[model samples]
Target: MRAAAATTFTVPAELSAAEPPEVRGVPRDGVRLLVARGHGPLRHTTFRNLPSALRRGDLVVVNTSDTEPAAVDGHRPDAPAADAPPVTLHVSGPAPDELFVVELRTPDGRRVLDGRAGESIRLPGGVVATLMAGHPDPRVSTGSRLWRARIAVAGGLRAWLAEVGRPIRYSYLRGDWPLDAYRTVFATPGPEFASAEMPSAARPFTPEVLAGLRRRGVGVAELVLHTGVSSLEAGEVPLPERYRVPTATADLVNATRAAGGRVVAVGTTVTRALETVADPGGLVRPGAGWTHLVLGPDRPARVVDGLVTGWHEPTASHLLLLEAVAGTALVGRAYAAAVDRGYLWHEFGDSCLLLPIRTVHRAE
Candidate 1:
């Protein structure tokens, strides 16, 4: 399949890429959340008000896959002993078998680190990653200086990251906040194996919001999509990361359909997981596996009828997944509304909740 290409909406470098809303302080569940119908315009609301937006019997599928400090400072194994450029190994995904996909870069040139597959690089706190085979060029733009590759991590992965790695904060954040802020309240205790940034949807639905959903008859299910480091370097094409949808979540997805309820993916990560497991009938089946599926206009969505997600920049590949659900026209409308009305962008910004066309009626 043709890789989903980048859009014009990616925030330009000149635009201030700060994360927090201007003049606002942090609140765990208080970020803005917008709701849009498949064929309608965007509506604004805070995340705490999510239960009011959905009906009973709607199922919310969340990605429980936590974030990892995939970005590490390292030196090139092949570089000359003294003058080797200080390199950053931005981890991406595991290829078929145990091999990994990693991005390697230096002041001189950028390339994938493959020749030393299985060689261990000790991190700041004794954590090590066994270098693995490299995969395709996941670059979205030409002339990018950063490269994509993968690696096999060793030791208590989560613990190791906490000790040595900085939270792989996106460039827009200006400075890094505590990694804890990036993660969801429900994140599994272990170190994240894949995603570079925390999938933000799980952020808003705290225990209280979740209980409210449950009381209102909403069913919650968890899926895993270990995300890799985002290829957000200037002029770089977005890269694909490793992802997995566990069997139990798949079953809940199917069950939600059988019960005639909406299957609502909580974030792009969950959307990617469910889309990976879809069959010819557009139904999701039970499975625990990896995926490199890139959803966009060309890729028809099968499992999710609606989605709740953050307001990503135009360049973010996540928008392609949203296009799959809302269609290009609807996405354009929602985005226009988001920008015109001053909706915050990025993980710490506002969110958008999209409903399927059939459910959102427009009176003439």
Candidate 2:
């Protein structure tokens, strides 16, 4: 089957939901999933079967970036003298050194603002958010415009979040979902103030499933990437969220490659982590830093050889990263199969495991 080109896939608004899935804590590896080869047809499966899908010595890279309850609502300090209407501040992104950038949505429009460095944005009921920095992301209008910003947080951000911030629920499932629904089963450490929801590599991996994969010879590695809240706004412009790949994670990837193992990224985040640090010939080195690198068809991958991820919306920028690995033909084929099979879309939907075109051919 031929895959569709990057230009051929577009995000459709109808597919996104205003609510999240009704299911919660359904064993990370118990989620429904699909597997496809190149642009070929899809095969239905459970997430627990993921390890069986790969060969021994294939390195599976997972993003351990935890989801953050970064959404906050408040009134603008620069509010007009007239009646001060409340504004919604989504602490969508973070800057270097734990500073925060926030999206301020008000009657005027959505604007990106920075909280006073080390100062907090006081919300209704004593909830205070420390301002980090103010670097505005590109904007899109939806009756009111939407702006993405980063923010720094402290003083029980996670505990207080249970009381104030709502799980940055996608427009799906029609109602609010519990926080556990937005996280992976193996989630450790408190949530970061960056990701709106989990990066989800751990989505399909239960403790048992991970053990099985290890038994089968698949080596797994983890990395932390504090992703910003997902801006699923229709027609939203794509922007890079600042992230860091720790030296330890880099070492594992390098060791795997040195041993001639296939490095399989668990999600786009892992792909970003590997690609961000990789040089030519797919050589990986230890490093920590921010990456604005965007991948697509024209750009070849230096580190990642495969990606395991959920179906993306038509407007999602993730389509570009998919193209970089499997090419337009393979991704298009897999996506079409996903649609025809009635596989769910978005974070709660089924997933696909994509291998490089070369690997598929070699297997053939």
Candidate 3:
């Protein structure tokens, strides 16, 4: 099958969801859900109906990675003595030698910061981040715009971040939101903060939704994939991120498959973690490590039979993964239907389910 990695689409700015449905006076689970089956008619439903949409034997795997406050406001120590533009630092992930893979954005979140190597930037709460080098990935094409820097904080990194950092937000958002808004309902409370951004597919789920799934005999499993900064720019490839699939979850997935159940991933993060440790026979194994896996038309899914995710941006690289799960033709139809129905797009928006169908034809 031909991969659609290079394919592009247009998303109108008006269709972007500037605020969460809850902020608009709707419940968390009141968002829309677009159900797209391979070669089947597209179905429009609500997120609360998820429990009734799947079979009893289906296993839903979710990412339990907690969101970290990765964004912080900073200023260059050596700028013009008059007026220096403030910078926004987005901590992508950890790098070798206590360094961090960071993206330098302007205060408006429109362009990257113009800084040179060896420059010192003063951040909030007395933290100083120094640019150690340019693009860390040698495999990246020449003139890449990413930055690699090291930070010096008085206390521990996590503790200091908790005090000064805010959740990384894009320009589309209406205003600043608290860190709690970026976390999923199933997020585990612990010292370890994993994702640089939210694993948003499960954001629409609430306690009521989980209870419904449990009562319907649908199994839910958990995995952790600390995601890095999202590559929202057009044609940008995502960087590697840490992931872990525990033995319990792997066993559940394998057992469910053996019992003629579908393995449904709640988000792209879960799908990436499971596929990384999946054997040729499609059996998942317990594993933990960093993965640079990128799913597209060229990469066919072997472990995940279905995917529950949110509507992605037109230029988002994640669209390639959706195309891999559902064919190109089907994905096209699904997006058309979503836009036609005025479904919201983004982390706090609606959801979509791509499942298998008996027929292999495009929806009309």
Off by over 4 Å in 2: 1-27, 39-41, 76-86, 96-99, 105-122, 126-134, 137-163, 190-194, 232-238, 246-248, 359-364
Better of 1 and 2 by TM-score: 1
What's the true lDDT of residue 350 in model 1? 73
Per-residue lDDT of model 1, residues 1-364, tens digit only? 2444333454444334365443257565677777888654466878877888888878888877666666677665455646544665565545545555556544233444343444444445544455543345433333333333334346544455556666655445666566676788767754336566687777766787887787888888887777665555433434555556667777777777777788888888788778888885656776666566767656768768898887776656666778787676667776777776677676667778888674421111
Ranking the candidates on lDDT from highest down gives 3, 1, 2
- Model 1 bad stretches (over 4 Å): 1-23, 39-41, 75-84, 96-99, 105-134, 137-159, 190-194, 232-244, 359-364
Model 3, residue pairs in steric clash: 3-297
For model 2 the TM-score comes to 0.77
Residue-wise lDDT of candidate 2 within 111-206, one digit each (tens)? 444333433345756655544333443232222223323332355555666577765544345665666767775555644454756786556566
User: lDDT of each prediction vs. the true structure?
Assistant: 0.65, 0.64, 0.81
TM-score of each: 0.78, 0.77, 0.92
Task: Pick the lDDT winner.
Answer: 3
Order of models, best TM-score first: 3, 1, 2
Q: Write the per-residue lDDT of candidate 3 for residues 1-364, one digit (tens) a residue.
A: 2233543556778878888788988788999999888765888989999988888988899998888899999886655724656888888778878788778887888656466777777887667888777665635432346667788777677778888899999899999899999999978856665788999999998999999999989999999898888855676666677888999999998888877788889988888889889876677899998887778755667678889998887777888887766667777887888888888888888888888652221112
Better of 1 and 3 by lDDT: 3
